[model samples]
Target: MKIMVLSSYAPTLFLFREDMMNAMLENGHQVIAAAPEPEEEWESKFKKRNIKYVSIKGIERTGANPIKDIKGFFSILKAIKREKPDKIIAYQAKTIAYGCIAAKILNVNEIYALMGGLGSIIRNKNKKSLARNILKAEYKIAFKSCNKVFFQNKDDCNEAVGTGLIKNEKIVMINGSGVNLEKFTKKQIPAKPVFLFIGRILKDKGVIEYIKAAETVKERYPEARIQILGSFDTNPTAIKEEYIYKYVNEGLIEYLGSTNDVRPYLEKCQVFVLPSYHEGTSKSMLEAMATGRPIITTDAPGCREPVINEGNGFLVPVSNVEKLAEKMIWMIEHQDKVEEMGRESLKICREKYDVKKVNDVILKTMDLKKVRKNQNVI
Candidate 1:
């Protein structure tokens, strides 16, 4: 079977869905990645794997950009025509919407939209605005058109149904794109307490809360280190450049620009924190768990699933700086518990988020066996 995978961020796909891709390729299916033109570094990595790749223009998030939407739809339509893939797998909102539209036009047999995360546009409670309405409409079109919608967390699945975005029966919940235990192996806890927040340096990711928590913790434990990785995104919720600079200059966080490898940092940290507003199931959180680092994340949707609260880590309410700070401080004060929680984290991740197991379930749902049998018969 020829499978065309579409996403705005190709590196994200490589990071989260690499196992699935390798499994599909190993099973003798042709895999073609259709996404934004990746950076040279990412493109080089893809080329090294000898995977076929194509570039498409698509918005990263929900916005009132019909002009771009129409253009992206047609761009994807052309790719569909050229590839004539037997199946299409779309990830994230924009790519999923455009991919579904193109698949419907090209009459593709199987289509799957991976709702990795709902993002702030769709999930934001305060929605009395034109942009919100436009985003809602986009959801209706994109989700309704897909053959199946794969969600990462129960909250997203329930919300999609409650909002009539997609039927409950149409949704399948999978572990946040399963983590690669091999790539992110267990590590020894560092002596000095280091808390890491690894995600897009967006305001919605609770960057402000992280900074506040870092400051509070630092005041008491002066030697405690906090690091924020991931790039500044152009998303509406992204942290403003000025605010980022201010925080950095004030010595609140040691900012390490985005890097291909995060394991080194993961290994160096005693605890990982992600105060995200929401998530589809944060790959980074799972990576942190796999690396045996206790977590501190929000109690919202995708963000809440990974941490078992005082078992593997603590959970704070979304955007609650005081609560986030308290949780971080708890981990700092009870440093001995860090290793125990890290052990629990590793246990949970290895048990529930084994990449191969999740990918197998996905393949079964897509009827890979039946498809393969039919092809062989032909």
Candidate 2:
């Protein structure tokens, strides 16, 4: 059988779904990965894994643009026509929405999708926009043909049902993409307290709050190291590069830019923080937890999943600078308890967010076992 994986970002396939796809390959399936142009040596990276890379252009990953959407839809349509895959798995907004429709047009019934998050526009709970309405309409049209729709959190699933995109029968909830326990082993906590935040430098990610809190926290506890690790994004809620530079230049924050591997940074920090507006499931947080670092995150959907208030770490209100700083200060004051909480974090990660455990659930749902049985019987 031929299985095609659709992704808006190239790294997502390797970073998130590599285990599942590799499992499929081992089960006697040809795996073809489709996405926009990659950043570095991803084409070679995929080739190294024996996965075919298909580059489809005109995919605007962050925002909604009609010209780009139309072009992306056709590009996917052409790719689907040419590859003629037996099954397709697509994630992210553009890839799921357009890829599903393209597969349907070609009469492919084995279409599956993962809603990582509803997208940045829908993250705002207060305001409603025309873009949200358009997305709802597109989701409604495309989801009718999906065999199963995997979601990282229940809130995202409920939101989809509320929008009438698909019925309850189609929903499958799993932990975020999950973390590689072997890759992110727990290291010794740093001597002095250090707080780390790793994510795209976007306003919706609570970066502004992190900066403000970092400034305040620095004045109170100057020894506490605050660092931000991520690249500037093109999302509408993305902050200008100058803002990040302003804080970094002023010595309020340490900007580490981006890296293919985050384990070293995860090892350096005593605590991890992400005040995101929302998430499908936060892979970065899970990685930190696997590295035996306690968490401080927002109470919103995906952000709130792994935390047990006052247990592993604290959960601050979204966009609350004061509360965010309070938790950071608490961690600094009580260094002895920090390691205990980190142990709990590592425990939780192993129980629930281990990559192998999560991939087993996905493989079972995808009917890999049943397929293998059929093949053997023949």
- Judging by lDDT against the true structure, name the best candidate: 2
State residue 339's C-alpha deviation in candidate 1, in Å: 0.3
What CA RMSD would you report for each candidate?
A: 2.9, 2.9
Q: Candidate 2: global Cα-lDDT?
A: 0.85
Put down candidate 1 lDDT per residue, 195-242, tens digits, no spaces. Answer: 998999888889888998888888988888889889887788777767
lDDT of 1 at 208: 89
> What TM-score does each of the candidates earn?
0.93, 0.95
What are the clash counts of all predictions, listed in order?
A: 1, 0
Question: Which numbered prediction scores highest in TM-score against the true structure?
Answer: 2
lDDT of 2 by residue, 1-378 (tens): 778899888876777778777777767677888988753556778877778788878887885779988998999999899999888989988898899989998998599888888866665454467787777778877778788988999888888898687899998888888888878898999979889999988888899999999988999998888999998888888899999999889999999999878988988899999999898889999999998889999999889999988888999999999999999999999999899999999999999999888777777777755345212110
Steric clash pairs (candidate 1): 203-239
What lDDT is reached at residue 86 by model 2? 87
